[model samples]
Target: MPEGHTIHRLAQDYAEAFAGTEVRVTSPQGKFSDAADLLTGGRLTRTDAHGKHLFLGFGPAGHPTPAESIPARPAAPGRAAPGPATAPAPAAQDHDDPDHDDTAPSGWVHIHLGLFGKVAFGPVPAPPPADTVRLRLVNDTAHVDLRGPTTCALITAPEKRAVHDRLGPDPLREDADPGAAHRRISRSRTTVAALLMDQKVIAGVGNVYRAEVLFRHGIDPYRPGRDITPAEWDALWSDLVDLMREGVRANRIDTVRPEHTPEAMGRPPRVDDHGGEVYVYRRAHLPCLLCGTPVRTAGLAARNLFWCPTCQQR
Candidate 1:
């Protein structure tokens, strides 16, 4: 599954490619045909992402939602919407509000690309879709294809709000209240690693981040969330904001510090398919970057957990 940064990057990409233009929306796979029919020829007014969910806001500011224009599936329970977690700042109050335009989204296409889903973008003259594409949006200069997503539904503004309501605050958004995430994290008896992976505890953090961030801060993965000091949670939240924002900009997750880069360490760049210079995400038994101890891996939160026993000792 893609992390929050990837979804945030896609939101920016979508906005860049088609915002303000009348897009031809289609569901070649036929699953989204009814909603697509209602959305076709509508202008893509905005695009947003929160956690792993993506939202394409179609509007002239008052377009009818699929629920009103066509029969649509009920909003999926606990479904999140995609948008960047803007950096912390007082000026960003309206960053992710659906009503930022002074009115509701009018209509929204909500997408969650689970594990097997993929999105691709290219210049105009799109080829025949693979029949697996759940959604396709095209305008004069570019086209994007959505295939195999766990979600591809048309939703209303209030439904979008419900999705956000169920999610924990995302560090990538400026409007995020680190206090909110800390409140939950500071009270839970769950392992900090498990708590970090919980979408309701802190949105957008996944397995790689859970491992790397804890490793970065030398926090033991098995430590209970309730044991995490206020200062520690503040540092972790700040680090996540920086790392995930850089992930969005670079389009990859590279969590190594300046002194630990491949060049600085006199080592070759990491060669994993995950495409980032992470410290311990998938290193398994490889030597720890800092202490040279063999890294460790275990199952936690239904995903592989990696850490350096020596460096991240409790």
Candidate 2:
């Protein structure tokens, strides 16, 4: 699955490519046909991301202020995939937002690209929908197709807020509070490795960042969260901000330092499906970049975690 960095990048891409424009929406797979029709001629004003989820806010033609709209009803939970809940309409008397009536019903498209989900963009006159394409959005100059997403639906404004509320602060989010995660970690008995992957503890972190960050801090992945010192937690959070930011900037997960890069060590650039060079992640049995010790791996939180036994022995 793509991590928080990938979701953030996707949000930026969608904002740049389709936001503020009236785009034709369609459900090639027929699953979202009703939603496509409801949003066919609407304009997307903004795109947002929280952890692994994506939200696209829309309004009617010309996007007149206070234009009332209704949130789409949700599909059955037992259906193929789970989705977000709908928020109640803002009260008619609510005047909190002077720019427009806050009660105006509007649509919020929530998208969660699962492990196999993929999004693609191309020029105008998009080609005939591929059989696997679930949804497509086309405007004058470009179009985007989504396939296999764990979630794709039109929800209410409050629904979007509800989703955000359930998630932990994302390291990539400017307003993310590390202290929230610090408190959670300080109270949990779970391994720090497991805690990092928990969305409620820290949104957007995945197996890759989980392993690399722990290795970078010389912290054992098996250490209980409560046992990790506050100083260590601080270091862990700070490193995550730096690493996740670089991942977004370069669109890859390179975790090695200048002196340890494959080029610097006269080794060929590492190759893997996840992209970019990494230190101990997926480098099991390979020599540690720093200590020449064999990198190791083990099952943690149903995923393989890689680390250097010697370097991260602390």
Candidate 3:
């Protein structure tokens, strides 16, 4: 499944490419025909993201989202929307609302690409879409195609709010609050590894992040959330903020420290289907980066858990 970083980059890419322009929305596979009709010919007001969910709002092309319309409010309006765990800051405080334009009742199209979902973007006059294509959005200059997504539906404002209400905070957004996530984890007796994958506790964390972040913090994946100290939780959340940010900018998930990269370690780059360099994640039985201890793996929450026994011996 595409993680939060990938979703965030989609939000950024779509906003820059399609927002503020009228788009020809269509369902090449006919699965999203109704949803496409709702957005067809409407200007993409904004692109919003929450954890694994993506929301695209439709309205007049130039109708400034309260933030961009007013000159007195010197704030940038384009940012990821809040999820269930986050509430938008007061409109009076900042202009960064998630494309909450006051026009067009078509509202937002909520998209959740589970595991196989993919969106392909290219220059204007999009080429023939694949048979599995679910949705397509095109402007005069650029276009994007969606396929294999677990969800592609037209939703109302209230429905969007409801979706956000069910998710935990996302670290990629400026308004994300780690305190609430910490509180949720503090009360759970489940293993920290499993809890990290729970969207309700901390949105956007997946199997890869769960393994890499735990390994990065040197915390035993088997450790119960209740047994974790607040200080440890803080460090974990902080590291995610930093690492996930890099993932968004670089458009890939690279979780090794500067000293541990392939060049620094004088070793070959990672060889995995995921397309990134990771530490203990899929390196079971291999030598640990910091120590010679053999990395190990086990099944946890139906996902493979990886770690260095010596480094994360907690």
Candidate 4:
């Protein structure tokens, strides 16, 4: 599935294309038709993302908050195909976020793109939507399509808050509290790798970030969370912020430091579909970028974990 940065990038894309405007909401697939009907003429007043969850706020037509009006940035054209095959729709109970007002007048459309979900954008004269579209938003300037999302529901303000209340802190959000995540991590016997992948423990980290961040810090993936010192946790958290933020800006995960980039090292750019240079993460059996040790991989938390065994000594 797409990482937290991809979700945040989608939030920015949705805001730039349709937020604050009167949107034509529809569910061509008929699954979300009722909610779309209710939101059809409403203005997209706000857009938010926490971890992999996305929210598009709808309310009566009025002035939108300045915050929702982000300046457009150069992004990849058309579709964002970020994950693997389709899976079951997500349960709202899994991911956590901070609560919005429980008494607000507007409603939120929560979306979680499980593996195989995709999002696409286009100009105003959008072509006929495919029968698979779960949601579509149109305005004078652009149109966007959502397909195969794990969770797409029209939720009341309180319901949105409830979802957020259950989630751990999101590093991308200004409101995130690293200490909250540290508290949970410092007390757990679980491997730090598993803890980082747990949404309930730390929002928005996926296999890619979890593996790459650990490799970057030379941390053993098998290290228990309780064994992670506060200073190490702090450094890890701060690196996540920086790397994920760069991911948002570039719309891709490139975790390699400047000196390790292809240009700096006189090496060809990485040729993976994920489109990022990194020390580890899907580079199994390849030489480690730093120590020239063969990168290793194993199953952890149901996802592949990659690291440099020589560098990430326990």
Candidate 5:
């Protein structure tokens, strides 16, 4: 699964490229034609994400008018309507937002690049392959292909409401409450590793963040969440906020400190690529940057867990 950082970047890129403009939505593979029709030609008002899910909303225009009141104009005289035009469709609102007019709704296409899914941006004429193309969105200057996403949907206001209702607060969201996260963590008896991956407890955190956070506070991953002290939980939350923010800004996750230069840190640590960049994720048996203790690994919750045994002692 692409971690929270990757999803966050996808959301940012989409919000910048496509929000507030009419998008040509299509399911190249024809598997998502029904969902695509709900989105084709609709202005992408906003792009939002929660944990592993990406929500993209499309409708006739202006902030999605009530489904029952949108004026469904007759199809362009002779041109047949491509798909079902739901309730009342809004008038074609001009893209005149003084704040951003040049940008197109190229990026607002919600994508959940699951484990094998990914996205690419550029003027390249051809994409990876048609077999892999799930969804494609285009504007005058850009093209976005959602390849291999595990889940893709054309959500409406009510569907979006349901998604948020079930998700835990995302650490990256401006309104995230660490106090709430602490309360949840303090209540779980699950291992720290499992707790970290629970979307209902904290959104956007994955295995990498889990290991880094545990190591930063010198907490053992095997420890039950309830066994973690309040002070330790406080430090974990602070560290995670700082770390996740840095990731959002850099578009990459940097778990190691600069002082621990790659060279000074010794050999380029081995990691299970798993199709992602890494530090301690798979650097098992490698030396810890802060201490000489060798990094260790084991399976937890069916996912590989990495740690510096000596540094993150029980």
Candidate 6:
């Protein structure tokens, strides 16, 4: 399954390409004919994502707020000085904002690309694969195809609320609260591996990040979440935010540092970088990047879990 980073990136791309545009929505696959009608001729106001769920908000004549609407500003002063008679400082505003509520369609559509789903953008003149196309949204300049998505529907405000209510904190959201995720995970007696995979515990974390985070923190996946110290949990969340941010920017999960690349310099290939750019993921039975111990793998939560026995001892 595509991780949170991938979903976040997709949301960003969709927002840029289709948001604020009146799109001709269609169900080429015919499975979503009813949902397509609710979205056809609707304007895409914004694209929002939480964990693995992607919400594409469509509004009527009024444009929906873009994700960038909530610009991050410094906290306001606790109390404005009692006397503001003097020239009041110009009202603070986010100058960096480039978003606008432009003329567009008024409708809403939401899609969740479960595991194998993907989207592609092309000019309207170009043709798309008719067979695999699940949904298509087009404007004058561009068209987006939703292929293989697990869920694609026209969602009302109440429906969106219900979906968000079921999810835990999403690390990719700007307003995400790691403390909430930490507290939730801390209460679970489930194995850290299984707990990490639970969307309700922390949205957007998949098997890859799960194994990598545990290995990075030297925490055993077999350990119960309740056994993890609060400080450790905090560190895990912090590290995940950092790692996930990198993944979003790079569009790939890279646990190994570039300097660690085997052909990076004059040095001969390092054993770990024989194939290059990973610590243990898919490098099972290979030598560890930190210690030279052979990387090991085992089945955890029905997925292959990789780690260095020496580096991540129980």
Best by TM-score: 4
* Per-candidate clashes, comma-separated: 12, 1, 1, 2, 8, 7
lDDT of 3 at 193: 94
Off by over 4 Å in 4: 67-105
Q: Write the per-residue lDDT of candidate 6 for residues 187-244, one digit (tens) a residue.
A: 8898888888888878888877887888888887788888888898888888788777
What would the TM-scores of all predictions be?
0.88, 0.87, 0.88, 0.89, 0.78, 0.81
Q: Give model 1's clash tally.
A: 12
Cα lDDT of model 4 by residue, 222-299, tens digit: 999999999999999999988887788788899998899999999989999999888899999999988899999999
Q: What TM-score does candidate 6 reach?
A: 0.81
lDDT of 1 by residue, 127-208 (tens): 9898999999999999999999999999887788888889899887656888998899888899999999999978889998
- For residues 49-89, could you state the per-residue lDDT of candidate 5 as single tens digits? 66666655454544542222222222343566332441112
Q: Which candidate should be chosen as best, given lDDT against the real structure? A: 4
- Residue 13, model 6, lDDT: 62
Global Cα lDDT for candidate 2: 0.78
Question: Per-residue lDDT for 1-314 in model 3, tens only?
Answer: 88988887787677767767788989989988987876788887656778898877776446544333211111223644332222221111122234663443347788999988998889967788887789888888998999899988888777887887788988876667899998988888999999999999888988888899999988999898988898999999999988887777667889999899999999999988887889887888999999989999999878888888789967
**Model 4 pairs whose backbones collide:** 96-167, 97-164
* C-alpha lDDT values of all predictions: 0.80, 0.78, 0.78, 0.82, 0.64, 0.69
Query: Over 4 Å off in model 5, which ranges?
Result: 61-111, 124-129, 263-279
**TM-score-superior candidate, 2 or 3:** 3
- The TM-score between candidate 5 and the true structure equals 0.78
Per-residue lDDT, model 2, residue 230, is 85
Candidate 3: lDDT over CA atoms?
A: 0.78
Model 2 lDDT-worst window of ten:
81-90
Stretches of candidate 3 off by over 4 Å are 60-62, 65-106
Cα lDDT for residue 95, model 4? 25
Residue-wise lDDT of candidate 2 within 1-314, one digit each (tens)? 99987877676567557766788999989989999999989887656677888877777867643322222122233443111322211222132232576333377789999899999989988899987888899999899999999999888876777787899988876567899998999998999999999999999999999999988889888888999898998898889888876776566788888888877899998889988888888889999888899999888777998988888867
